[model samples]
Target: MTRRRPPRHASADELLTELGRLTQQALERAELQKARVELAEALQRELLPAELPELPGLRAAARYAPARHGLNIGGDWYDGFPLPDGSLAFSIGDVQGHDVEAAAFMGQVRIGLRAVAATAADPGQVLSRANDLLLSMDTRLFATCSFLRFDPATRELSHARAGHVPWVWATPDGRWGLGEDEGGLPLGVLAEESYPVTRRVLPASCAFVLVTDGVIEGPAFPITAGLDEVARVTRAGVHAEPAELAAAVIKVADLTGHADDAAVLVLRHDRPPA
Candidate 1:
């Protein structure tokens, strides 16, 4: 005790060395986070569709813009595929959270949907099976999704919602409308949740738009404002091709900070052969 253990102090060089080691660890962590983000972006590009499916009597286009805010890479997703039952299926969804976990889960959910669509004839039934599939996955996350089944031959469409936004429809004949699909609880929340199928007869040259909540309820843009803006721009772009129409709708959103990701999938009903 008298010696005092040389004041129980560390050498200057030793302290400096420890500081350096800590700084190195911090740098390593930063690098790891960056790598993860890059990986997520690449995975998203692979997972998301580069082009919409080719369906009869419909011109389809889609756009996916990731969020610009912190860790904005998230679970927003859209899919358009042809079912074996001779109908075109389109869906848009957002899983909870905005991290790599959510993105990975989104991939799983989308794959489940595509597989279930093959046999399920009704949009509501498709969603019900998808919900059960998701529940079985045991992921501790929920998602909102909207599914639509369109029969191009009869100009008929059926929509199902799982706590998702309604589709916006703008007609070439100067008619603007919104889907009447009823919303149920989000998927993975309840095993017995039932989605209602709402059917409508779409008119010729109608641009039907599907979007996530982020697309309509951003920090700067309220839902009503965003809806009005999208509807107006979509109507104005009604004569444009599907690709241009999607771009126009996105631009009209005027996204800033990208606090949340946005996806727009549009299927324009083409006039039948003369």
Candidate 2:
């Protein structure tokens, strides 16, 4: 019969040395993580527009906040630009995860939308083409977005959604409501999915609010409640400047202790000079 040797115990010096090595490794890993986060944040900032476009009758503003609990970088994004046909385009979206990959995918989605919007017939077609573009990429990430094209000449706004939170709109007279439009599957979900467009004329001195889900959803806060808070704030600020209203809307995330990244885009049609 073979007898097993007595188990050997690590000496005090060896134990201390091992602990030191582990501590160094942990520090190295932490530094690496920090560097990655910084890189991701820089990338995100580069991708997001520096300012929302301003048109003759339309005033636009947007605000973005990183997650309060997790990594400071995320996939929430918003953009505003003018189409070739003289219409203004605005979009806000959230990619699947809150990591570097998600940020990269967000850039891709934004580029796709901009590329397709040039020739796309409407908001629905724009989202559909963007969806197809994402599926063509060699990636598994998905995204949700709300897109709008506003024609300054006609005061018409066409909106489309892809599994995104509904927008909140308010008129100067204290009327407000949620978008509640029919939406399609998120980008990269189904190859054949098609988003539907909803159109309406803007009333004078009215505002439309678009937000990523993070702005209105959290561990302890329900989206419905958050949305109601946004509506109330918007109703009160319908006559305020787009920038002020956007700032107020984004403040709800902090007030509600929302842990995820948030973004708010406010579009307002100012009343013509009397």
Candidate 3:
């Protein structure tokens, strides 16, 4: 005798129960996603220095603003600390992506650089060690960084860039120029490479400006004239306070789209806050 087959159609109560179960699962997943995003952002902020250092004969200020607030936290970090030899070190960098993983990676690189810099103080060497750290993680991501170490007694500032954005330097005589020089590869691009450190005796009352990509670029926003605008703005306010100078420079950039995060750090020599 052939056995009767089970019913093909589910009862209304069974269907309702399944639907409720699915709805609960979806709600739980959404909440988990939100929590993850918040945690990542908090971690990113911790990586950056809360304020610039207070150094003799030197004034500094920095700001880090997310182009748009939310889960899209770009990998931008800025730091300033005094070395054992009574010198000050400033660094700004951007990791490859504007996602959670990039932000997390940024923290690790930032801390590693700081730990190595305290002993090395050579921007190039510090970055070389930091690069090794990144490669060891095997994250398949890279970062662009600019490091500046200033000597208070000599009034000299040494810098190194690893495929990072160009920094602006304004002389006391109102001349402004980009600090672009021959350098090595960016971090994570290769397992081994060396970066060159460029040094100069900064003129008294001079100012240097460091910025991330967001300040120099945006979504189709006057790309051809960005440098000219930056020069003009920086030249006019070369003598402003570090904080004011950073704000003024950023105010003029085409930050309309809020497409990428922006970071600005200003170093002023013998210039009092205004």
- Please write out the lDDT profile of model 2 over residues 126-236, one tens digit for every residue: 999889888988688899999999997888999999999999999977788999999999989889689989999888778999998788887888999999999999999
Assess candidate 1 and give its TM-score to the true structure: 0.88
What lDDT does the true structure give each of the candidates?
Answer: 0.82, 0.88, 0.80
Query: Where's the lowest-lDDT run of ten residues in candidate 1?
Result: 250-259
Which one wins on lDDT? 2
* Model 2 TM-score on a 0 to 1 scale: 0.93
Runs with alpha carbons beyond 4 Å of true place in candidate 3: 1-37, 222-224, 253-256, 271-274
Which candidate tops TM-score? Answer: 2
- For model 3, the run of ten residues with the poorest summed lDDT: 251-260
- TM-scores, each model vs. reference: 0.88, 0.93, 0.82
lDDT of 1 by residue, 1-274 (tens): 4654556688899999999999999999988878877776777778887667767678788888877656677789988888996788888998888788888888998899999999996989989999999999888999999998888677788888999877788887798877756878899999978998888887666888887877777777777677777787888888899889888777644553247888888888876776
Tens digits of per-residue lDDT for model 3 on 221-271? Answer: 653355556677788888677888888877644444546777788888873
